[model samples]
Target: MSTPAPEDCGYPSPRPRLSVEELPAAENTQPIRSLEDLAAGTFESDQELEEFLAFTCAERRRDVA
Candidate 1:
């Protein structure tokens, strides 16, 4: 039997194209001074800290990409 095409193999289709304006705004850039400042309670809550980390990771990915 013939193999099914990539789409017909049950994988989800690619995401819809989005215009630059339609995309989410980039995160605010922060200047990290030291490891102590990073470890300190700069963020108010756990959620805020998580968001900061996620933003940092996204920025790094974009830079590497």
Candidate 2:
């Protein structure tokens, strides 16, 4: 038994965006092992990163406060 989604959920229905056969093969799509590795990339601008950090920090504050 599953709940019905609202008619106006304001989002598309959850469906596969891509089929497994249609996906590209990944040669080196792996997780970074250390903070140093992540720090090596160049960001186009700091605004996007700053906004994400601020949003996450606010979420943590709300959870704890």
Highest lDDT scorer: 1
Work out how many backbone clashes candidate 1 has. 0
Which lDDT tens digits does candidate 2 get at residues 1-65? Answer: 97668545766677656655455433334557878867845655799779888999999999998
Clashes by residue pair, model 2:
none
The per-prediction tally of clashing pairs is 0, 0
| Model 2, runs deviating above 4 Å | 1-44
RMSD (CA, Å), candidate 1 to true, equals 13.5
Top-TM-score structure, candidate number: 1
Against the hidden true structure, what lDDT does model 1 obtain? 0.78
Candidate 2: C-alpha RMSD after superposition = 8.5
Q: Let me know the TM-score candidate 1 reaches against the reference structure.
A: 0.39
- The lDDT values for all models are 0.78, 0.70
Cα lDDT for residue 20, model 2?
56
Candidate 1: misplaced stretches above 4 Å? 1-39
Residue 49, candidate 2: C-alpha displacement in angstroms: 0.3
lDDT of 2 at 43: 51
